[model samples]
Target: MGFFDRIFGRRSAGIDDPEQLRRQLFDAAARGDLSRLAGLCRANRQAVETHFPAWQKVPEHLRSDPAAMQSHVQVLVAIAQVFAQQLGDASLFQRLMGTPRDNPLMRWQDALRQAQERIDALEFTAARELLTGVLSEAEGLQGSGVDELLPITLGRIGECHFESGEAEQALPYMQQALALCEQAGDADGVRIYLGNLFEVHRWLEQREPAAACARRLAEMIADPTAKRQRLRQAERVAAGEPRNRVLAVIDGASYELDELPPLAAGHVRFMFERDRITLRRATAANEAGEACGGEGEYAEALAHFERAATADRHDPHCRYQAAFTLLHLRRYAEAESAYAEVERLAPGWFHCRADRWLAGRLAAGDVEHDVFLAVHALQDGPMAPDEKLDLAEKTLTRAPRLALLHLLRGTQLARLGREAEAVAAFRDGLAGDGEPDVRSRLLVELATHCDGPQERAALLRDAQAPAGNLVAAATAQLLARGSAN
Candidate 1:
């Protein structure tokens, strides 16, 4: 017998399916059938599992998660009210749901991840709604152990607003996040929030506060030359002078914050159009990027790369370099987009998939700066492969644990005529859950390498997915060639 069965000695919950129970309970309540709802609860006092009633269907992760636990307690209170007189026990619900204060953090994780994907699609409004809901939940955890989550949550909401061209709306949240960071003595957090505040304030013509933020940033992140450079921007903002390197007209209403330019000296000039500044033609060499960035001139290096990539959307190198430079500058949020674009432009680009993975982690504030830097610094260096084997080896070692990377590795090895190693790579990539399209492609590739007709058919079957139009077409073409099921 289960724990609940033992506790109540075969008292029938009578409800096997939680979904049907939920429907019946809600229906009963809607029609003012209080007695029936109470009757249902009393009948379900001892389930086979300890979950007793509707709680049985909840995943173990949700049942154990701290944030969900708190919500569960709230649910217990309402249930107790419904069954209070019938069950004659107020503490019974507490025993079922556990003690609760508030913990909104863990409950917000899945929503935040989904929101990041939405943000990646430039669906700012939808992403903002998701983030704002989480932020509202954060209020319930004010004195709880998870209050540390508040600053970052607030900052993300601010970023959503900032990216959607709502500076005034972003200001208060940014300021609050910064203040929380200050209170928490998070120096790095303070530096980041201050940089963001400087961007918003200067754009909003709140120049005095912008100057203050700039000066603070200089104290935090500047080298000697960069120190003087930041001081100059601070001075300009303080004096309400026209901001430097902003090549757009200052009409206030239509002004957009493009890439954050350098504080003092800059390499390339950008022509900011009405909505955004698109990169025009720039003939600067890649070596020039390395040189300029050597002195921690990341802003200028970023500008150089963006310009080089403007009309050359097909060139993955420029976009990858720009993303790397943004990472170096600690502009993680922007780097996420840059790296994502590179991933789309060239999925097989040199370390693009791996770095894009890191960029997401960094943007979500999930990875430490030093950790991200260490991983980034160890990139597969300039894609100069002497042979396909070398390229495959490098890709497997340096790329993210993504099926697409392994697929590339496998394809490269196959081209080099290394059949055994190629098959191994394909199998390794398919070992975990992955993007359906990439997984389908990897499975299709593996199918072609199999010796037996049955094995080949099975692999092809595994590769075929509902959304994989390309893979489905490829599979059909292969099947026509007599590798049939």
Candidate 2:
């Protein structure tokens, strides 16, 4: 059956004597059919006047005044309430008395309240139908409170459309509501409408419009804390766009970061910083051709790193990492050049001098002393004892004066369960004429491997004398604490 027919039919079945005049009046009032109610009241005027004192004045009020129609509905509701009590049926009473008032503003509020309930129950179709009728009735209203009720009604209609996945259709209603709210100087209403517009535009993928709404929302908010929240929200919306698009959005608004409130300006500054970092990292990754060193795509990785270095010329870390990657690829001359640029940008930020020395050795075609293979291999996976031994042997042959290589060899031997060979390797490495940094590092390694307390103490003491390497001094202090205990 049709919707209203089914509703009336079910309600009519409950009343055994449906032909009763009071039952007909109750049904018309319950359905909110003002025309049918007026007709029924006119036809039964003598009975209504005699039975319901309050309703006797309604016919005269309706004929004399256009604004008196609300009072007429109230009288009908009173009559319905009496009939409901007599018949012991509260459904008619509920329908007629739900709104509790008969003014146009209250009627609109009642409709909105009912619509909200329907929405909460996931009855979108029923909510939409109710909101549509409310919208029509609200538009016809022309009284003091109409101005206040109309915008609210419009906004709610927009919400109905939005919640029902018709955001495109919601756009115009929200925009009209926003304009009305602005004209009425209703700040809260304006914010609500603007929020609706922003969400709708975002759902439609209209990025610029959504960002504009967010910006307007931020500007309209008066409270500092609330303004900051809106500004952050705007920044997040803008951040989803491409770099150029974000820049365009900021520039189009003609707002300098410094011109905003302190919290808003802080958010803008953070966005700019985040964008710079993201762009730099992305450029580096794209140029490198693979995420981590390009997985043997050394030439492409080098090209990407070089492009990254050029893209972010002021960032020393980018240049440094690029140089490191080049060293892995054994492009020693290019690695030397990149490391030199890093030193120029951030002097003494890393062990650049030592790195340059190694690069120079590789450039001379001396593969025996190359540490990149062992280092890169370690990055790949854990090394076997024989692999570490082979690397150590090759490193020792080409760079016997490199004390760190001896320490590495001794550490590898110790890990292989060959403590005697490890001890011998550490002693041999200690005899090398290396720099103070290398000597201190070797001493710390030997002290860690040594079992004899006196020997360990002597090695730590030698390492502790080095003022340049804080790590060795710290290691000695820690080892001394253990000995004392």
Q: Give me the candidate number with maximum TM-score.
A: 2
The reply for model 2, stretches above 4 Å from the true place, is: 1-294, 311-314, 340-354, 364-381, 433-438, 452-458, 461-485
Query: Which residues of candidate 1, in runs, are more than 4 Å off?
Result: 1-103, 142-145, 243-485
Clashes in model 2: which pairs?
287-304
lDDT values for all models = 0.62, 0.63
Task: Give a tens-digit lDDT track for model 2, residues 328-388.
Answer: 7767898888777755655433445446555766788754424656634533446787787
Residue by residue across 1-485, what tens digits does model 1's lDDT show?
67865443334357877667666655665565565666667676553124434442344666557676655444445566655555666555544544323324556665678888886765667988988887676664433345477777788788778766677899999999999999989998999999989877866778799899989998986477577768877887788653211232222222112322222332322232211122222234345676787667988887778767753444456787888898888888888788778656544344555567667767887566765543333233334323544544554454446465577667767776889988988988888447555676777888878677777777776654543434233343445344532
How does each model score on TM-score?
A: 0.33, 0.38
Weakest ten-residue segment in model 1 by summed lDDT: 272-281
